[model samples]
Target chain A: MSAGALPPRVRIVEVGPRDGLQNECVALGIDDRLTLIDRLADAGLRDIEAGAFVSPKRVPNMAGSGELMQRLPRRAGVSYPCLVPNDTGLDAALAAGCTDIALFAAVSETFSQRNTACSIAESMDRLSAVARRALDAGVRVRGYLSCVIGCPYEGAVESRKVADMAARLIDMGCYEVSLGDTTGIGTPAQIAALIDTVAAQVAVTRLAGHFHDTWGMGAANVWAALQRGVTVFDASVGGLGGCPFAPGASGNVATEDLVYMLDGAGIETGIDLRALVDTARWISARLDRAPASRVARAFPPTPER
Target chain B: MSAGALPPRVRIVEVGPRDGLQNECVALGIDDRLTLIDRLADAGLRDIEAGAFVSPKRVPNMAGSGELMQRLPRRAGVSYPCLVPNDTGLDAALAAGCTDIALFAAVSETFSQRNTACSIAESMDRLSAVARRALDAGVRVRGYLSCVIGCPYEGAVESRKVADMAARLIDMGCYEVSLGDTTGIGTPAQIAALIDTVAAQVAVTRLAGHFHDTWGMGAANVWAALQRGVTVFDASVGGLGGCPFAPGASGNVATEDLVYMLDGAGIETGIDLRALVDTARWISARLDRAPASRVARAFPPTPER
Candidate 1:
């Protein structure tokens, strides 16, 4: 349980612009979203989820994703990946000149159907087509397997089912798969078990942890996954996103909080903690809500205060 | 690590009444304080820090602690321990017919002097006298060592210093020693190293973790300690305490959040999570603040909402 047991360097997948804002009630314009993304890059985040190429009608908050993706500043060593649900979304991403795209699936049947309007098997079949087309277009594809631990619709998801879906995504040309506790109900023990079962099917190095802070177990879950050799993590600046099912609950773990923990552990993340906190504060102001990160709250009080 | 690696059951020492509320701006009457303690016991908390026997001028929130202790319902298994800083406080506790009392010291020299108006050596000398007298009175004495990880005034504190102080407290007749992260600045790696060094001097079973959630590392720190075989933890019901220096930062990790994680991990805490969350909400309402717990926030929205 020493620092040696954890990875020397951790790659954080900043999901604020996409997953974080997508679930927010307030809709930011493409310009505001671009500002958030720029701030994140300036804070030293290399992997940023810029936007999702889904329909604007269903998700008004993601209305200008295609435009946002096109206007994103392509900084050196920084990659902005967009989420593409089906072939149409893949087409939109391609039209917008997206070089990296993320494909998502759910391990739970009810969640898959509710989230994507298709069964788990059908969603995979659709994602397989999108992945094949995106790869053929020379785009690097990453996979997100949601509800790997628990589902709001279905209480507990079987680890075997998650592993099977992750293996399928890997087979479909995904370089890495991120296991997500969508409900944020997972404990460290459950996270450990899920990672242990899934790592057997997918390489441990190819696994990332995407945890929410709904139940305040996000940091502990990340620690568990880190101990099991998962280096990459998905976090949102300002701890954006509220659970639609569980109102007032947090969504993605805050990037500032994650960086604070990693920095304190002597784990190199290449991210500046002060700049990250500043960015969290900036974006939270734009969103008109207090940053949901404890680290951000713990920062020196603003001069206005 | 799996669930089997963790201890089967954990002893939670509820510090909300003393450590939590002592820092709050709003002061509750003794009746409200008694109600909080009663609700905590109803939620299955056995060890509660009822109040501090310090001066009312310094900490007006605990003015009627002696009277509060006299009015406490003598439950079958519940034990309410009050914080007694010096011989005068110990005498006050004894006069109140208290059977259990706690003594606190700081690991950092500056924090010891700043917090207790005495150096580390002097504070220990004072506490040793208090511990001796309390033990001779057929009372149980617990020890709290603050700034074990980091100090607001002294930056980083050495683990060796913390271990030495802990050993001294143990030798002076404390049944258990609670290591506190007063600044909430310790990470899992540091926590692991601290526990590893301290456990060599004192039995892990007699050590407790009292973490602050200022930087969102509380649960992770608790997990690290749990992995090192430390089973007891000190927590506040609503994450009640706030770091006086770090404006807007959290103080103690919420008891409800801890119970949620432990319950999800199949670890027996003997505490009902729903009941705990209710208590958190109730106390937070009385304090006119939102519960600083993700689990409490994520609970099914109140009827008023």
Candidate 2:
């Protein structure tokens, strides 16, 4: 650590509109999801994950990502980010004319096999092409590493592997990488140690935390990461994402809750929590179930037309 | 700080058997609830909250608390604590032959009014009487102070007020005091500051953290409390409590999840996490909705019985 260097103020990447709601059985229209994004941008989030471009057959909730991105207001300060699983998804993202595309790879073999049907090396090899294509097209690329802390099947991932994989993503031309506790299996100490180890190999600012609340340690891990100099976090709005280890294993950390924490701490995330809550309600009503995020469930107010 | 003194270890007061299932809209039989408590004790939670001795009309979910207490297995090493809201509830718990009983008091005027239909001062006075009676009956008393950090009606509570409440509970001869973030508005810094202030007037061991995951900082707050030498935590089995203020607000952190983190950190929670998950599933199935606890929902084993 630099002597007396001021820690970088954390920036939260709101993934609620995208990764959060994507796995729900809910079927939200394109407009409602986009409005949610617009509200999030207006609320203060500079980087808002719009949606993921994927197969509706697999992720029906994310089927409207392309349309949602096109209709989005594209607020002056807000950056609309979308996820692309592989080269095919990246092509869809670029076709939609998104300048910023995110690629995902799992750190745990079990999760990678379950989510992508590939090994870690194989998944990265596929995402490398996506990153390269996006970079060539003059687009920004971010990397997501899932299950960096604990895997549902394997459990207690080694920190060294996480750091090595994060370094590899950076070397592959990704602008930033988010380390995810996909199963919500990390303690503050484990998170601090992972960040410390990964920071040794990559710039601390390039690393972010993607924590699930399965074990209710999502925000705690984020706090530990921030203390270790991580400045970026990925949170789902109303904690929309469900655990693919099967939904309900551990849900995503609700974006509203994360913003509340950041706002209370005097951190600069530029996100309006009230706006996020409105988005959560709109999508939740469509799903015919409650918003999975704890904060959205706690604070529900109708949005003004 | 004593150089050679070992840092204080946090204690897990599993509230699943009592608090978790008590507020559910569904009605569960007494034997099922007793079985749940027995399983929790087997999982190694030394302080297992057995049941709540309240009016059946008010909290129908807890109608059979007295019978549940009478039916649950008596383990020599474990303390089966039951919740007593007033003198009548205390007598009911004593009639059931419970050795340990807990008393409830809310800090927020609004919460106390809604929860007990009385002023905070009035509730405290009643709890004091119950505490005195419990002491005379040779029953251990644990005091609960809800809305310690923030309230739904009134936001941003004072730490000194929480300290004062803890002092009163202790002064009334309670063995320990549990401070709750009932509405889940507290952050890590705020929690640390609150615990530090409370610890100044009372012994740290006597203080416990009971945080709701409504805003996703429950576990983080618990971590903060752990750092402050608070060894006791009050957690529900399936994240089953709700905030009356914010309709549908999440309840306390899930017990299985807490056990996972504590176990991972080498903290001795004395819980067999797999067993806890089973109990959570069994209770949830009977409730007609899967347990709200993410960990339990994620890892439900098909209970053969």
Candidate 3:
């Protein structure tokens, strides 16, 4: 938070099960999704995005999210969050006994229309209704602001628009807002400007960075965000998820790689790096792909030497 | 150079022809090496590590450094620097008409012994001789300090030792020193500490960051160094080179990716990104492997869209 000082510890929101698997070509079974959440908890992640309440026809891989929430092993400190787009999704999440839900919105008008089939204001209205209903049921709600940095349809996003959207989400009773670089086209300068603009209106503690590694700038952007006093991040295990807009681009920043850098920087993440590495390896094996995590690929567990 | 400001213009030392191709499983011919150098020059990279004068048996891929140098088209503004380990290598490099040479040493004692077949002190002595002779012969000598952050054999490296080695290299009449994370195991904190310590002993203007992307922290580390006044970076085209000590790891930061970040950040690199992207695609196709560069993979040149 101070000049050249990092937070003592940061919270990692594991989105491998929801944000990650939702984009994968392989349709993982409900059991696999449950196991992934369980492994993330065992690896000391307290915030895990378990699944999303979306149309099965649209996202077949996340079809059994409700089922996953029902059978997921409950941990003491871990909270499983599910994405709920509207009142219908919220009702399904509540029926499945979900305790935490996330509302997704886009700051760019074009992206808002393209992604959610509505303008930014209309999407916000829907999200506000879902947030209000979820809060009435004593369910904690988080918000995801996509295209906060760049949009595929639109070139660059305004920082003022991002700040206003985040403030609106917080006013709607969302606990935290995760800024998503959906196109992964952000550089450090843009990240600094965005964080600075948003921090002026909202506390840095309430902001989260969800960067993709499409151009290998994820860690750099994360560093920029940290310098601006943001302490929460969204990462996917084995770096699952690809940018549908930008072909051949990578997905979210790998949790293992993020944890490795955080730990090496002497920042406490309350994460078991080895255990997280194991989880990454496990899921990557199940996906029949080499672990997309650079740390997992470079530093596999070695016997005493 | 300042606390949070990046340099307006940075120098990119392209090492793809030598550092990159040398580690490739495919052995490119002398003509191909010349073509790679010319292509890099055409892409607006003035500084290029053209070849290294090493043992033919040890690195057959770079065995024809002399012939490649002889046939390389002489560009007025572009300089091809060769890696010269000792007096013998210096002699070969001089015979090849190299005007610029680089001498490498390791700060970690174990890495020095393993990589150069000598102790740290002995390796420095050899490098000192090469630097002195090259300087007297009107050749610009650059120093490379490897294992400045982490060593595969020795584990964590101390910043003080790295600073001392860099000071010794500068004292030996080397024009500049490129601090290298040979194992690619450095984090931002370590990068800041190393650069700060080294800056105390040597002018920050004379320091360069040569980070590998083995663990995907290359861009972040580079950003840290940039914050601390590093103005030059060593990157491989198509992300070539591999650490023999660290298996299954990536090579130097990809030149295209680095340039893309710099350009996006409003920094001047004097490179035509589209031309560089074409070079990466051209070379990658020759190797029959996808370009390891994230930017090249994501944003290929497209006709008016």
Candidate 4:
């Protein structure tokens, strides 16, 4: 990042409220969920992942995403996107008035089989169907490609494979595609190479970077992608949401850490970092675990405090 | 990182006992300190920083480093390094039977002024004096070069300047010179380039990698250094310790996370991940903050989970 270069004007998608909280076994009440989202909105996050609409039986923690969405503060201009894994999930999100929806795919065929109980082609077809339906219904679609660099089951995903997958999603009507190093096994050089290859097919403007901190290279991978002209990022609040598929995979790049990096680099992320800290604290307590965010832990020591 | 090939072994200097916890306002009991070090040792860590010997009035958290060192567990093949900023710290650590001592310097002159309350040359002189005394005492001296990539007072650090400071430290009889990206502004390309430049003047084996996660690139930076055949790394348990000169900087790369990366890549770190997590949890509780480790959270959901 150049010292006097104009800071990037970027849209930060806060995944804490949805992806951050959904995977936990902790059963936070709907009130707490609403408070979490409202607090995040107040913190200046223009795009917050309100919740996932997966089956409550499978994801009890996200049972009331619909109810929580209904009670959200009526704030114009702040887009709330939700996850849609299947038609049922799409219906759930649509009923909740989600104008933007995301569909996820795994780079490794083996991972897709285990994660979504479908083959790569089958999963893409499902997402394509969802994309077409959502687009016809006047909603924007975002595609997520997981394990773009490596996978626990299949290991080292080729860059060309990732780019092909991304291009397929773009052709399926996804306005943007997020390439995720779900296992956090990316080296900067490898990651840069991956982005370069992906950019050959997709415009950099239509790309977002998502990384897990499994091997502790999430932010570095993000930086590598950003240097390749990726402007959007997907972060979880308190850095929550470890991959259930990748047993040792940790949380995604932390929202607080992301905001700090952007702010330091003179990029405008429109997030109140202190407020994110408060949200991280609240959610972590609900889950009874330490927050995954470095910025949350690195907050200024209390004076007399 | 090849499976069949000999895995690269990175020597991680556990700095939590000294550098990590020294700046904390929290007062940990001697029993807690010993327990923490014991856990780390059991976790396969051969080098565990027991504590620092700074004055109680100046740095209250490290006042008991001298006492803690005296009561450390009698483990064979372990090196208990302590921070000896000057003659006083050196005397305290040596009396406590610490064979290894560390001295600090900064690549940025401005940071050296604020952090040490002295010029860079003055800090090096102090370090040289300590190194001479320790060498005469049959103790190994470890030199630290802080703000190697960027500084709080000085926004960007030149690689050549870092090499110069590191070279001086090695010449002063320090056994190994650990490079600190104090402001966490280093990217992989920058790191690789710096290592290449530094390797021209110094034996690569004598240099260690020390990075802060403030920008979320610490582990990536470590990997970059590793690719260039530099094997030593300095990490803190729970990713503790930040550059006091750089306000809001994240702590050093979490020890557990570093061990995970090395282990995952088929490299030998000789550190047990589970034991490291336990130690991190204990210390994080003491400080009333979350562990800065990604792998700790990335652990498989326990039955107690």
Candidate 5:
């Protein structure tokens, strides 16, 4: 790759409010959730996954996402997308006035079975109805393909299978397909091959990378995606949220850390790194844990010296 | 760059024993140092920085490095190198029957003053004498240039100055020059520029990447170096050794994590990752802290189900 082939700018889809907090041990109050979304918006993130519309019985941490969406202040250029797993979830999101929605399916049969309690095909069939309804309602739809790199139960996954699944999602009216390394087990070489395979079917511009930091390969995997011309990325504030299915796995790639690297690379992300760090610290303290973002710890905001 | 441009194999200089323990909160006993070295050798790391020969008053953790080196069981193909800061350190190493030695300097004047208590020119002059004496004694000398990307005190460092320092080290009979991100403040773009600038004066093969994970950019920076044809790297076991100068910074990139990424990228490192992870867990437990290597935590060895 030419050194100059890197994108001049990249879009960051903040997923902490949904993906990050979903697995948190302590449930953040609705006001705390609103603060997170508002802080992320204030930090200049244009796209934020506010929350999901799944049953509170399954994911209690995201119980009042609809209320959060209702109370969330509308920013001029910001888009807050809510994840909708089925028709009921989508209906709730619509009732809450969500203009953007995300539907997720796993590329591997084992992950689809264990995570969604359905086969890959069955899950896709379910999501298709949700996607159709969202599109009909004029809501922007984003597809999430879990286990795009590897599955905890199934080990390695074929890149072609991931690419085919991504293509199907795009055909099902997803404006963009986010390939999620749900188990956080991807490497740069695997990422390159996966992106190349998926880009062959779906346009690279329509793909976003959502890597977890379980193995500390998140930023490196993002670099691999950037090299392959995938511009949009999904990261979480404070690196919150581990995969409940993948025990011992860490959280999603921290948005603050990603922004630090991107800013240092001279790429335009339009994110205030300091503000993101503050939000990360704020949420992490409320959760009674250290912020998982290394940059936030390493370069903590210094008082005016 | 062609996908095949990546090197088929890479050499890792495991520096956990020397660079790692030097800055630790607890001073591991001599037996612990030997066990760490022996375990690293068992894990198929041919090149390991076994210890250092600095003043014990300054670095108490490395006080028994000479004795540890003397008693270390000589392996058939393994090479243990000790960090030698000056002629006295080199003399101590020689008295202890060590053959491989590393001399370190910083590209920035402020780091030289703070870390070595000497100016850049003065430190280089002292190291020049040590290098000559060591080469006369048939010892292999390796040069370490700290703060190649950024300095804790001086902030951003010029790539040209770093290259000049590396070229000088090579000219002084160092077999290889390792560029160190002592503060771990480097980005992939900066790594690329640093490698590109240094390769202009020295062959890329004679250069090694020694990055810290303080900002979680170590692996990404390593990826950039690999793309620029750098095939040698330095990492610590369990991601040990926080920087004394840079508060709240993480340690060197964990050797297990680096090996995991390299192995997944299909690069031959000749390392047994399971053994490395076991060693990391063992030492981390002894230190009363969790292993910083995320892979070790995520994929802990499980008994056959």
Candidate 6:
């Protein structure tokens, strides 16, 4: 597709509070997490992933997600999607009064087994039941498919497998499916091929691009996906988090970088670039590290322009 | 254009020693610079820019370029191009027995005045004279037009001005014109528009993309240019250099990142990714900072992955 074929507007699903913080070395308290979500909302983000309801022992960084969710201010037009891996996590999200929830499954068998202690088929079985319960309760459910491109353990993942998994998620009542390059090992061509294969099984409009900047192909991969009519993306505020599988590797593509690119392309994202940059700096300072975003580094937060 | 329309092979002009080192804080001695160039050559980069022959007082980092040029190893098929700004710089390059030289002009008027103490027309006159002299001496001259996308002093540079400058350089006996995003403020759409406009004046085959990763759009911009049928790109090893005007900003796109992207896309760059990463680590160690490349950071030059 040509550059003119890019989506006119994109929905950015802010994943900083959930995916970003989960892999960070320093975990923020519930208050800081609330402020981050508020700041993100104030910056014009309507979809924000608040936190995951995983076991606190497994992910200490997300321990107070339930309490934080309970204390979260309800803003009209803004939805905070919390991740629910199973019935227990879904119950926690429900207890926190979450109306939007996300479920994740890995396409690669090794990643599926290692991350959730189940095979791909079993993980899908569990997620299908959870999606049923969430939809029955009137909660919107989104699906996340990891290792859509390549897996650290499995090397190369077949696009056919990813397509099958994505199709299954949609059949299970997911409103949208986010294809993740979990290891950040995908290039633009690989991203385009994956999107093409998956879009054949699921509507392109119902797909989102979840890319990591591990090899610095995150933005390029997003561009490739955009050319293929994928209109939603998942990004972290300050490019928070590192690949647990690859130490020192970058995590999600920074929301600020994504906004800068989309805005320059005349694509409306409804995000305030300067405000988002400020949020990036504020949170990175709290994390006691410089923001991993190239935009954040180029335009420093001090004496804001 | 579809991803299938991408070029089958690309020529990479490695500018780590010249453009990359010029803006870096640490100035390497001639010996270390020689080693860096050698390592890059060993990694399969044929078009390596060795250094610049400018005033030592202006750019102290390139003080020993004349001597460094004389000592550069002449590997079969490998060509070392040195930047020559004016008649004096041309004389220095000739004295060093350099056969390949590069001339630079800015598309932004204010940047031209500030960077070279001359107007755009005047800078062109100087470069024209230099190009004439180098061509008379049988030296191949390559042209560089900085701020092709945007400028620090002048916010938005007209694409017409960039096209005119690139065409003029080509007319002045320069074999190829490299369009540089000096401030690194361009998005992919802007890049595509600029390429389309400039390619109208100059053959797309005679053009190269030189991008900086200031806002993390370098790789995406490259992808945009690739779709436009421009195959040559200028990259720096380890993403050396910073925007001299924008203090904390990034400089050229990392060669490792570019090679990784190209390799994964099934595009031939003829460079070994592992060796390039190793060289990035080596040079970054000398500069006492981490390599500014996400690829380098993700695949640390550790126990050899």
CA shift at B157, candidate 6, in angstroms? 0.4
Docking model 6 quality class: medium
Q: DockQ rank, highest first?
A: 6, 1, 5, 3, 2, 4
Lowest summed lDDT across 10 adjacent residues in model 2 chain B is found at B1-10
Write one digit per residue (lDDT tens) for candidate 6, span B215-285: 89989999989988899999999999874345466879999999999998899999999899999999988
Measured against the true chain A, the candidates' chain A TM-scores are: 0.96, 0.89, 0.96, 0.92, 0.96, 0.97
lDDT of each: 0.90, 0.78, 0.88, 0.78, 0.90, 0.92
Count backbone overlaps in model 6.
0
| TM-score, second chain, candidate 1 | 0.97
Across A1-305, the per-residue lDDT of candidate 1 in tens digits comes to 55677789999999999999998878899999999999999999999999998889998899988888888879989999999999889889999989999999988888888889999889988889989999999999999999898888878889998898899999999999999998898999889989999999999999999999888998999988999999999999989896344455677999988998888788999999888999899988887887888899887754652
Clashes of 3: 0
Q: Pick the candidate with the highest lDDT.
A: 6
Q: Which runs of model 5 end up more than 4 angstroms from their true locations?
A: A243-247, A302-305, B243-247, B302-305
lDDT of 3 by residue, A133-198 (tens): 899999999999999988898888899999999999999999999999987889877888899999
Choose the strongest candidate by DockQ. Answer: 6
Candidate 2, residue B7: how far the Cα is off, in Å: 6.0
A139, model 4: CA deviation in Å?
1.9
Cα miss at A131, model 4 (Å)?
1.8
Ranking by TM-score: 6, 5, 1, 3, 2, 4
Report the Cα RMSD per candidate. Answer: 2.1, 4.3, 2.2, 6.4, 1.9, 1.7
Roughly what TM-score does model 6 have, to 2 decimal places?
0.98
lDDT of 6 by residue, A1-305 (tens): 45677778999999999999999888889999999999999999999999999999999999989999999998999999999999999999999999999999998999999999999999999999999999999999999999988888989999999899999999999999999998899999899988999989999989999999888998999988898889999999989877334455677999999999999999999999888999999999998887889888777555734
Kindly list the per-residue Cα lDDT of model 2 for residues A164-237, writing each as its tens digit.
Answer: 99999999898899998876767777787788889999999788888877766777777767767887888877
Model 4 residue B72 CA deviation in Å: 11
Error of 6 at B241 (Å): 0.6
Where model 1 places Cα greater than 4 Å from the true spot, the runs are A243-246, A301-305, B243-246, B301-305
Clashing pairs in 1: none
